[model samples]
Target: MALLAAFVGTPVAAAADDPDLTSFYQQKLSWERCGQDLQSGARSDGAGQPPGFRKRLECARLEVPRDYGNPGRSTMQVQLIRLKATGPGKRLGSLVLNPGGPGASGVNYLIDSGNSFANLGRRYDIVSFDPRGTGHTEPVSCGSKLAPPPGSGADDSLAAKEKRINEACGRYSGGLLRWVGTQDVARDMDVLRAAVRDDKLNYLGFSYGTKLGAVYAHEFPRKVGRMVLDSVEDPTKNAWQTALSQVRGFQRALDDFAADCTRQADCPLGTDEGKAQDQLRHWYQQLSEQPMKVKGETVDETSYVYALREALYSRSDWPALRQALEQLRHGDGAGILRLSDAGGGSAAHSDSVPARRIGQDELPPQDQLALRAISCRDTSERYGADDYPRAERELTKASPLFGPDIAPTLLDCYNWPAAGDDASRDVAAPDAPPLLLVATTNDPATPYQGAFNMARELRNSSIVLTYRGEGHAAYTTGDPCVQRHVDDFLLSGTLPKSHTSCS
Candidate 1:
């Protein structure tokens, strides 16, 4: 697959002349085979690498400055994993990937699903790295003690909790806290791109990753080779706007789920979609008052809502969600508890959804800390003392089941000490080659409209590939049409015709 023949190029001289980054770009990666059994560790010494070497996957660490602005100060290691191209044809450089969560382990994601990218791997070196402050990359640790207890509902008290967390992170992470934003990561990607000998970046990013890719393209348009942003996030939205949009998107997904459930004989939400939502609201209220006990653990309103949010990320998990709701109604809170655990990165499962336990899938406390730290510092939106009440009201109006829960979490940036840089920008990458934007109609995390908004922002330089379906991301969802379009785009610089829609 000679994807993007125009993208082919000999290694360009280091993209930057900054003395601080000269060594970084010149550094060579000593790749070593890594096995699947390796536990995901927070250190950069390949502690996450399996005990015995394996030929299929290779791991390496790249050193980058903790603060690019003050590169002389300190440095951190970014752990990366690669599955080299197994090609009979000419290799097409590296295809970097990120799996969304500001904290998700990209290397771990690639290791778990390397085969899924085999088609591309045969033509490109599939590379993924743990971004700064995540996954063995000098992880940011605020300590698990600072985290709110499970099922802790959104309330005024959360402000204090967030303040404490911010303080802890500041104390623990020191100067590294402010440098963990998406912009910093985008710059890091450029350094990595040069280190890997790719003259131009070939990248695929999903969810939060979309934001990263957009920032990268905005920052280094000329370096962008072939880029794909799936489940697109709108860069023009402020923090509050993004959160509110997600709250509404999730509600829409729930409504869709409810409507689907009504068509089933064993639907626990009942036949009327509106009534079904009301039932869910009532259940949440009841759980708020008294959490249901299951296997010595309790399922509270926050847990239930978060679990539903996670299950709604993909349609494949809908059956599990239904079973969970049914089990909850029957006085067995185990199902919901498992779902909540799964949402929190646990490997718990029910018959409906078979959960795969990746070593890095279960986020450690440090990764969670990194997620909050990066998110708070990357967005310009902050909740003020007076904003919460207004937000709560609007959220409840937008979504009865998810509004109240979703609204309070935004308070995370309220007391955060690290200031946010504006991550939302109008991306104009005219020098960059055309890119593909994948969006699902009812994507709960990054809503569908975001894709259109991003497409409009990119203008003629981008193509919108719409999947008229439900799910957070379009590709790798077992949708042949979506896969074919993506494969065609990534494998050959063939852009889908404008306004291409897939089912």
Candidate 2:
């Protein structure tokens, strides 16, 4: 299939008449302190309010072409949040970061994770952005998330719901729906790199951000400098294979969590392995029949499953998953709801309603919608009603626990109104400098094996940094060993020894 979807490359006029992109690349951003503009407040443990903005964080908006192929046609506002380097040492220019949501808000990530990179921040300004179709960057939404209207037929088949979602997305996403793919975002990053006055792009990305970074390296090989891709995603896998791989990883983590849960006296899942499995399945059935209320939101099987799946991303989240399950048993679902509201980066799901603007507290969250849209746009594969059953069957066989919940997601691009491209399906950046890819041996979201594949595909332009631990990404796990290796690379371009593994 021609990778560029129907919406791509069709000249607004002709290729020869392309508008000058010099202006877009040369524009300067107006930086200001982040406060109410981003609903700044210290992020509490819960998801009730937006996270607190750091006192010294600077925020700005960047303008790039909505469609780079036709820069003169329209433009998009990319939201940027930065924490300047605290310079006791020499400045290392700007180290841009992407918090791995093909749909999540890097702007929010900058606020939440800015301090994690304080070590790097001493010499490099930590910058992050909300890419198109995510967060505050003209997010693609499926209208307002309204419950199905009364008499809205009971055909809740995945095909039926996906059809509505595709319709709603096409209805609301406008011209950018098909353009939010990683290929486009990489171009935007290049513009960002130029706008920041940096000759090369120094980047840190997690999960999907790794894919984005790899795409960037492929596009602008010589422009890459000191890049880190944590929780590397396999570029070889199609959307279906990626889903199956991730499900297996999560199921393994779930099993491990269950084993540990039974050892605890207060484990909600109880001590018997068989009983624990049965009990959790029972919750799925129970929630499906009678959705519980928490914070005025319904906690159905979909939300419950997302909550469970997200908590599996890191070992640190296991305790919260336990609490959410415990609360579920007690008919108090705030814990589960919190996880649902906070889930994204790799995979997350939600419902839809009438149209709604991208703003604070929008249901389904911009991240999930962006994930669905961008995932479709990045691939040329389009499933019909027929493909759903086969995909679901294979997915279920892969992991009985999460397979069913994740199966419906196979059709995320079903009859997508806009055509998609396969530009990201394959990446070849032979000219790019060696990239440091951090992979956890037992990561639930982006499995470890994929890291090897990604490195091989980068045509050996990557060295794997293995973290023999549990988590979604290593840098945020407070592992001094991992941090030491990463800092060493970014600080002085020192590569860790071959076969380096940190506990």
Each candidate's lDDT (Cα)?
0.75, 0.77
TM-score of 1: 0.87
- Which digits, one per residue and each the tens of the lDDT, describe model 1 over residues 1-503? 13322233222333466445566766778998764444343223333434421357788888888887777788888988888888977898999998777777877677555566778888999999888888778788765455443464644254555555666777777667788888889888987887787878999888888888888887787788889999888877876787788888888899899999989998999898889988888889888898888888778887888788778878999999999999888877788888777652211111011122112112235556667778877866677667778888988899877788767656666667778867536576666677899999998878888987887776545988999998776786768998888988888888899889999
Error of 2 at 12 (Å): 23
Name model 2 segments beyond 4 Å from true: 1-19, 40-53, 145-156, 270-275, 289-297, 326-335, 342-363
How far is 394's C-alpha from truth in model 2 (Å)?
1.8
Residue 205 displacement in candidate 2 (angstroms): 0.3
lDDT string, candidate 2, 238-288, tens digits? 778878887788788788889889998889999998799889889988988
